[model samples]
Target: MPNTIVELRDVAIYQRESLVLSEINLDINKGEFVYLIGKTGSGKSSFMKTLYGDLPLTQGSGTVTDFDLRALKEKDIPFLRRKLGIVFQDFNLLPDRTINDNLLFVLKATGWKDKEEMDAKIEEVLGRVGMKTKGFKFPHQLSGGEQQRVAIARALLNDPELILADEPTGNLDPQTSVEVMKVLQEINRNGRTILMATHDYALLLKFPSKTLKCDGSKVFEVVQKNV
Candidate 1:
């Protein structure tokens, strides 16, 4: 139980009073990589949002990085986020800023005050994502996969306990998606817990891990066929 990073029991997630997923039970341990798969409107996004404090959890109980989801307040969201990294379907980079600036902005907003330390962390994360040399480039100058790599780099800047990726490869071509996936896989290999929401079944086949599927308001694990 001590190594569990995310745990939910009898949990129900809702969006503006509409119950999305109910009676969910999941336990993710430290250094694990889990996949979330489902069709459109099947509550995968809602479930991910609930984990990162974007959506409120009104019933049952859940916890992420030791923060209780039911009792989480707005003021506590930032603190909660500091322990988690979130990646969106769209590469949410600032268009006008270079990749370095985009990463720097997050560091500063998250309370990084030292110039030297901020720069060091920015480089370190970019290096992890294999984008160290591209930091001076603007987001528009890079390909979709490159942009997503930058996004992943940004996510790793805080040394988060968990990385919640919501359809991260949704906008990329197949090859590009794999490239971005490698970055995430490498991060996971280095001990960062990952929960990725994806519709690309090919990825599931290629880089299979423990998968959970959202179907008809319930979440359950996908049974892997014996090879």
Candidate 2:
């Protein structure tokens, strides 16, 4: 049996008063690398927000990493988020902090208190993304790709069960995008489940997987060739 990490049934996604997606049913099993693809205003962001508790599931039932989306309280959001890792398009790193400090901040916020254990985890995640030696540099000191690698490392600090990457490579050049993609792929190969939202069709062709496309206020799986 497949270990399901994300499961949504009869789910409706909303942004404010507008309904973005309706009657959605989806499942993402553990150890799978799934892609969410769609044009702008096609409900992809809304869907992801609903999963991460940024938007509430007002009209259906859903669960991400075992937290009930519908019953997820504002206070419980932080706890839910700890079980999942999120990556953003622009590499949301603090300009004032070095890569190690940025990652340390996350660990501290998530209740990791041991100095030696935190240091070991920081090194481990950075090593996973091949950013082990770049931890001393600030975000502005690194290139776009390198900053994103640090972001990925930061996401892994909690050892999340599911990773939600929202347009992770949207700001990179083609070659740089591939370099970042390779890091993500390496993470997935090591048994992490990843759900990435992207509009880059070129990446779809290069690293095809189970893809879900948001269209016309509905989310459905598309065959790899169609993607």
Candidate 3:
């Protein structure tokens, strides 16, 4: 049996005395895809923050890719981030740089010393997302979907073990959302775990995977065995 990639045991989060999440217990194995659904301000973003170290772990224990999130040091965040990929609703690409430069910047920041290897990796991931020809283009030059593809490429540059997407397709049209879902699905099929927080029930019906829902100030595994 394989080890768990993401584990949250009795995790709790508070926003300056206001508790956002209460007792979130979960275990995500390698290569699994999960949907996180909830209302606005229902601690969905807070959960993502906890996983990425944006918010300090206030209670309970958690781990991502073997890193003890509760005991993680500040300097160790970069290392943990390398094992986890985070995607956003708004494509956070550097408008001033070309797509290739955007990816190269991350590689450099992550301590990549070989320029040739970085360039090769850039080309490889861009091709993987069908954006090989757009590496020279700036973020402003591409459509919404194209820019998002570049962001996805950036997230993939490190080849993370798991991808945490916070409303990845929230800003796109219906057709474009499907396209983005295809990209994410392909990534999952290739053996990377995906934990996407989405309000799109169509996506849930279309993809059909485990659903982890944030409700009643706690995160629960909503499934047939318990339903």
Cα lDDT computed for each candidate against the true fold: 0.93, 0.91, 0.89
lDDT (10s digit) by residue, model 3, range 18-115 = 89999788899999999998888888999898898888887999888998888989999999999888899999999899999999999999999999
Cα-based TM-score, every candidate: 0.98, 0.98, 0.96
Give lDDT tens digits, candidate 2, residues 1-227: 24989999999887889888999998999999999999998988888888889998999788898898889999999999998999999999999988899999999999999999999999999999888899898999999999988889888888899999999999999999999989999999999999999998988899989999998899999998877
TM-score of 3: 0.96
Model 1 residue runs over 4 Å out of place are: none
TM-score of 1: 0.98
Q: Candidate 3: where is the Cα deviation over 4 Å?
A: 224-227
Q: Give the local distance difference test score of model 1.
A: 0.93
Model 2, residue 227: C-alpha shift (Å): 2.1
How much does each candidate deviate from the true structure in C-alpha RMSD?
A: 1.3, 1.0, 1.7
When sorted by lDDT, best at the front, the candidate numbers are 1, 2, 3
User: Per-residue alpha-carbon lDDT of model 1 for 37-146, expressed as tens digits?
Assistant: 98999999999989999998899999999999999999999999999999988989999999999999999999999999999999999999989899899999999899
Tell me the lDDT of candidate 2: 0.91
Candidate 3 accuracy as lDDT: 0.89
Off by over 4 Å in 2: none
Error of model 3, residue 121, in angstroms = 0.4
At residue 145, what lDDT does model 1 achieve? 90
